[model samples]
Target: MSLNWITLRVRDLEASLNFYHDILGLPIERRFESRGKQIVMLGTGAQPKLELIQTIDQTLKPECGVSVGFEVKSLDEAIEYLKSRGIPVLRGPITPNPHLRFFYILDPDGFEVQLAEHS
Candidate 1:
């Protein structure tokens, strides 16, 4: 048995669409609305990828302690891009250890996405 996909319940589809696809640069492949809800697929070139599905609650706030970590070629580069796009960084890429460095940022939906670099 294997996991297939994880769906995040998003309050605002437009806001999440810009954050995941525009700010973070995830490639959006498809989008559609059904049963009064919107769904968008983001391809990661791998199975068990992420799908951001939109619901009706626009004021919903995500619960604490749920984090998503994504690694990039250069954490600095990502930081710069995010800053330019007006995304606020909540923490640092400061060296926590010799093998780990991460910075956390809150998306529009209050989801924590940790951008980290492992050397």
Candidate 2:
């Protein structure tokens, strides 16, 4: 079986939309708005998309049991861009065992997303 999309509950629709789209450069496939609620679809290229749904919970905090590790060509460049934007970068572009270089970032909702170079 193949996995489809991962959905996230975002605190602020506008900020989340700006972060995932403008900041991260993920393209918006589609969007729907109703009853003060919003659903945003994000994708890179033609790959599977991520669903960002606005949350009604004002106190919701992004948690970590599982985190998405995104593969990039260079972690250094990715982290630099985030740093330039003043985003909180939790860790660094270190070679863990010579097979990967990775780091973590705290998204707007406090969710941890990792950037890595893996093969």
- Best-fitting candidate, scored by TM-score: 2
Steric clash pairs (candidate 1): none
lDDT string for model 1 (16-109, tens) is 8888888778888788877877899876666565688887776666765777778877888888988988887897867878988889898778
lDDT for position 49 in model 2:
86
| Tens digit per residue, CA lDDT, model 2, 17-100 | 888788888899999986878999898665778889998798776775646667788777888888899886897757878787
| Regions more than 4 Å wrong, model 1 | none
Q: Which sections of candidate 2 miss by over 4 Å?
A: 34-36
Per-model TM against the reference: 0.85, 0.86
lDDT of 2 at 74: 74
Worst window of 10 by summed lDDT in candidate 1? 42-51
Residue 26 deviation, candidate 1, in Å? 0.9
lDDT values for all models: 0.81, 0.81
How many residue pairs clash per model? 0, 0
